[model samples]
Target: MNVYAQILIDEAKTRGITVKIIDEEANLYRLCYGNNSVLCRESLTEKTCAMAMTICDDKSLTHRILYKSGLRVPRQAIYINMTQAIDLMQTWNSLVIKPASGEQGRGITVDVREKEELQQAIKSASKYSEHILLEEFVHGRDLRIIVIDHKFVAAIERKPAFIIGDGASTIRQLVKKKNKALIQTTGGESQIPINTETERVIHHRNFSWEDVLPHEQELQVCKTANYHTGGTIIDVTDEVSYTLRTAAEKASHVLNIPVVGLDFLVPDFSGDDYVIIEANERPGLANHEPQPTAERFIDFLFPETKK
Candidate 1:
């Protein structure tokens, strides 16, 4: 478990909530309540336990159920073999390859255009799980919508927040300085490593990391807006439009899951249209800070149960 995960558990306990570390992998499993131990354990039957466990462990099934419920998700294909992956990408030259069962953007590759890169991405992503998802690359920003008990709780817009060079410092130095601050804010998850690919991207623009610096800002860096890749997260729950709310709520209803975090890619969620990228059962509640998603989660779990 990550630090944030542990913080969530601790926060729940502080609210007079009792949480047991069950061997089960369900993200948020409630094994009954009240002062009766035997009764609580007996209350959750095999079928109910299976259902709760099933939803949290699988992401492909989550999207399938949401799609049937009328949510606009990205065009994607689930592939098990290398041949199937190549065939799926044939239709779309550019696509995202990721593990169907992973979260927190682990083992996810975006803009895989060449066959070699595709194969590499597949091999890398496959390490996380047997099933892989090949999704059409949607040109838009990443939007995260948090839902609790059939209601929208919080929303955030994650944008890659990178600094450009002004022809002064080395890329390594700039990256180090940026990471120093990012680690303090994001608990060390947002620090982007200076790699050859990143340097190439800078070089492709006819610039070098040495030409840019802490003093002079000359060259532009970064093409994508992923916060995990040293981007910025903007709180936009108040700015979310009715369309986004409807899409998110409908997605939750379609999945038949009480707690969910829906991701969307769009020019603007306050606008008329957008694509419902995917739905997550074990959505990271720690991403939305200051708002305290853990508190909302505790409220959702023990709401009146504690009283």
Candidate 2:
């Protein structure tokens, strides 16, 4: 079962709600409280309309819709031609290329500073999507704000996967050790791929797999801050500023989505400046530990179970 489904199941159990796994492989489950019953597949549920999910599923459409509503979004476009991408890069100086519709940071390339790297990024993104997106690289903290029932529930700062040097272990060794720790903590669900993407990220940082990092130096190994891609999440719910909270809540309202995880790039949570990158209709409710995300979701789905 996906961790998200298990989280809801476990939370339901604590509330004396009946939980039945309808399809383990699909991570589908049913939750019951007296006469009320609700069904969910992972974090998705009936609260999300098909149209909202469809809009969120398409990144290009999401941007257009949100932008038209006057919400801040990174300058992006559905790919038309290689020349268009190059022109955008030249004007913006940095670019982000990724599959127009994907999750968990799949087929995403960040910090494309040159033309040759842009070519490779497009090729990588094309592997996953025929329609690639070229976005102006926005600089800021990567913040994920979770909105539930048109209200802000939690916020987190997701940092790219990194390792601190011990002065002895090579980058390869550090990565191996980090992956093992990630598996242990996440129950083998998350791992950093030891593939060409990893190699490219390190190479761009002027390091090799065999290079021994200086003692206590930090090196970010992955460009994508996604759990499945070895990134770590820090709960920042209490630290969220009013500006960030309102932006997230308003964005959710604009999309008419009751539950969503909106990804944004901001200089800081206290600032008004932020660019909405993507919205996940079925965001992982369990990611913000000790924040009662799963419990709130249950409350929203089965109001009678509320404490």
Using TM-score as the measure, the top candidate is 2
Which window of ten consecutive residues has the lowest lDDT sum in model 2?
188-197
Q: Rate the local accuracy (lDDT) of all candidates.
A: 0.67, 0.89
For candidate 2, give the lDDT: 0.89
Model 1, range 1-307, lDDT digits (tens) per residue? 3544555666656755566655333433333346522111211223224464476467677666656767777788887677777777777767888788866566677777777777877886788999888888888877988887778888998775467554556776777788899899877767664754356447666767665454555443443445566767788888889988878877766666666777888887688678876666656667787676777665665675432
Q: What is the lDDT of residue 244 in candidate 1?
A: 88
RMSD of each: 5.2, 1.4
Candidate 2 at 221: error in angstroms?
0.9
Worst 10 residues of 1 by lDDT: 36-45
Per-candidate clashes, comma-separated:
13, 0
RMSD, candidate 2, Å: 1.4
